[model samples]
Target: MSNSQQQYPFYFKSTIILFGISLVCYALFVLSDILAPIAFSLVIAILLNPMVTKLQKRGVNKIVAISLAIGLAFLIVAGIIYFITNQIVNFGDNLPQLKLKFNENLANVQQWLNTHLNITIAKQQKLANEALNSSQALLGRTVGGALGILSLIFLIPIYVFLLLYYKTLIINFFHEVFAEENSAKVSEVLGATKAAIQSYMVGLLLEALVVAVLNSVALMIIGLDYAILIGVIGALLNMLPYIGGIIAIALPVILASVTKDGYSTQLAVVISYIVIQFVDNNFLVPFLVSSRVKINAFFSVLVVLLGGALWGISGMFLSIPFVAILKIIFDRLPEMKPWGKLLGDEVPTRHKGEIWQRKRLRQEASNPEKEKSL
Candidate 1:
């Protein structure tokens, strides 16, 4: 076959592959309510597997080991929920006074704006009231979906338990998908994936703990109320990547402005968060999360945005691990190796000087008589 004829099939195959990916993405978006918990549970299941294996090696039964793993996971989650709930309740008790203080601050802001910008306080108040109403309506709609939240809370653990229980079968299914000759490669990939994901989970938890402690201590020193609660909430939200940090900074700073003495305290809170974010993005992530995931910053942000668009917050949280797993798969297959390179963090240094090198060699090859004379 001629070169063009041979290339036609390659182009057709590429188009088909692209179409397939698009279809899969659409299906995932449509089925997010079902898939989100399953995806989350899969990550938890992977994290818990090593513990289960250790228990089994110590003479524990598989069922007992699985139960212990699930129990530990549930307890950890429950403790966090209880602590946050208690803090929220305590904060609620002071809500009325906080509301009055907030109104005073708003009036001061409005008066300042009116004086400086010639904007009437009445107009500002009208806009504020409209915004408040819209926020309340949004909150009402969110609260109306409590059942879905409850279902996810209930189903996630159950899914984790079942997934852990049947992990061997899942592994077997994965192996069977490939040819017999590729079994060793398949096993290697599976092992690498487990190790990477487990390390990522552990690192993420440690990072959260470190961040929460730092934030709480900083806020406490600055005399911010509910320092621990705000710190912990911010730390947890920070797990969601770019968007989370902005929300984290806004939450405590807004509260500090109302509760604290002056704008100085609010500025301190903002500065503290900036420092925390700097430490996190520069140090903690590189040392902890990045070592495990190895995803480029560009692809990481893109995946998070796409996830949020398709499945909201849960998707954003899960997207990194999901893409990491995909990268692992792509790396193992020769046909997908280019994709693996694209997803990786490192730029290809070898390719930087390749074009000039090829041109020089091609010119030399065409000038054989001149080279011989020299």
Candidate 2:
């Protein structure tokens, strides 16, 4: 009967609602393998929507515009695959020489260890042999694997096409679902979400191009083998945020150690990667992606890890935009604005009046001598 007892019931109900939502999210993540292609398709649809709109405005039929957009996307994907396959084949052709270089480098490392450390040559050789055996097993399982390749060959394009075709319907459905009361708020959130995603994809693509070119040039200048392959792979991986940088760095260093015949070359490769990552993090990412997502470093890393765990690499690649979409939704909801603040980089200040007053006073303080001069 008491007010406090009534409040307790409300709090308990809210907790139950939150718990249900969390459970739903967990289930979705567990089913992510099936969902990943669909998620990627949605992302592609958002990216292509502007082009579709532009074509429509130019007197193209809606269906025709959608078809043209999808065709262009397919061509882009095909071209990338062709280029990557060619680079891979070229690398494969040079494998024999690369293997010889690797053995020579291993022998040199063993000799260096024998001279400097107290470990015996026989013990080092045993360890090397064990490592080789483990690596062979791994390659047999990974390269001989059929599941991943089949998914890429069959599933991806099918999903992408369906997504493009249904894009308008999906958007309209969401708009209608939320238009019961605050249609304007729903529209604003949807618009912001689309803009954020589009901006992110565009910026990320440009960043990758820049990184690929820089990495290729650096590796070529250093006279390392498979520089193009390393550069291109590095750039693509770099699209995944935090974890991608390390992978990009490691690939070059590993390849250099195995192909170039010296620790000095390996060291150089490492240094080059560090420099590239430095430029990318400090300059490229901030300039390109920071404004669009507007989430802080902590949430970025958290979402990426969660995404990786949920959908593997595909999830990681899509996580930021996913979170950005969620943030937009949360920001528009009165009770969920706190959740949005938690997801965002800048905490929304409730004391805006005080903040502005302080800023104005600081400006006045800086110009006191000017005021006196006037």
Candidate 3:
């Protein structure tokens, strides 16, 4: 058969691809406890690579440069942790007052429901008791989750150091696997992935800072207690794509309802968040985070939801970068370019024929003869 005329079995190929994807997903889910920390470490190591390179160019030893970069990153993280811990400590002091306000609101709600909806306070208490039981179980799971987080905190740094130290071996392994046939393409993909990730990570941090400031300022203007703390938290959660934004909004709204009298202040908080979200989605994301990663919003949200389903929050956070790396690789390979386009944000350009076709279709309502002839 001529090369151009060669035919492949579409169904078989698709089946194989589907099976491979399923197997990989299963493995990822099963080994998530082991893999998630490693994945995070690799991303952080990639982010720190430029610093290591710059230090090495200045005659710093490779090992020393890596150590210095890691140390600097550690100190910055520690400082942030300390600051947030202090905030939490201060926030704890208001718990009693918060509880009192919450109880008062709950009573008012019960009274309103009794008057308007004809629901009794006894029925509401029964429902609340059922919810409290479920919440207690949730609290236990949360405690276990905290311990897991602590373990990851200890493990990730070591993984990052090892990954950085063996970075040369990792690069060489890719070249060896691809061999000479596609060595150049592999190198290009690697470089592009690294640059995209580096820029995206740095830009993500900057964007989060801007969002935190905006949130804090809005809350402070409305005189919300613990505004700075809640704002910082919301900004951090907003890093996790679609779902985080919902949770971020809920926290302040709940606080507003509990602490403030009447619903006007709560309404203001919601309005403020809606405006901030509009600014964030339209302006901040395009300029900072989305500039490097070109995945379209539909797939971005889909992958995030899929990632969360498969590997929980770590997967949600990791999904975009993973998809971006895939896109870069896909676009380079001739057969995979279509797949790259599927994930990419680029809109398909309209040709003259398409526009002309639409114009004809619109005119066809008055031209039954022309439509029948066609």
TM-score of 1: 0.85
Cα displacement (angstroms), candidate 2, residue 48, comes to 1.0
Worst 10-residue lDDT window, candidate 1: 137-146
lDDT values of the candidates? 0.85, 0.81, 0.86
Error of 3 at 302 (Å): 1.1
Instruction: Give the winner by TM-score.
Output: 1
lDDT of candidate 1 over 1-374, digit per residue (tens) = 98766655788988998999999989996676677778888999999998999999999999999999999988998999999999999999999999999999888888999999999988987898998976564333222255448646687888888998899999999899999899999998898888888877788888899999998999999899999999999999888777788989998888998898778988999999999999999999878774444888889889988887677777778788888888898998899988898999888667847988999899999999998999
Give lDDT tens digits, candidate 2, residues 1-374: 88766555788989999999899779876565566666777788888888888998999997788879888988998998899999999999988988888788778878899899977889987997998976564333222335445546676666766766776687788778865776677678778988899888889999999999999999998998888888999999898777788878888887877865548888888888889889998999888764455787799889888776666667778889999999888887889988888888886546768899999999889999987988
Instruction: Give the per-residue lDDT of model 3 (tens digit) for 306-369.
Output: 7776666777888888999999989888999989989998887886689999998889977999
- List the candidate 2 regions with Cα displacement exceeding 4 Å: 1-5, 9-22, 100-162, 347-374
Candidate 3 regions exceeding 4 Å error are 1-9, 107-151, 349-374
Clashes of each: 0, 0, 0
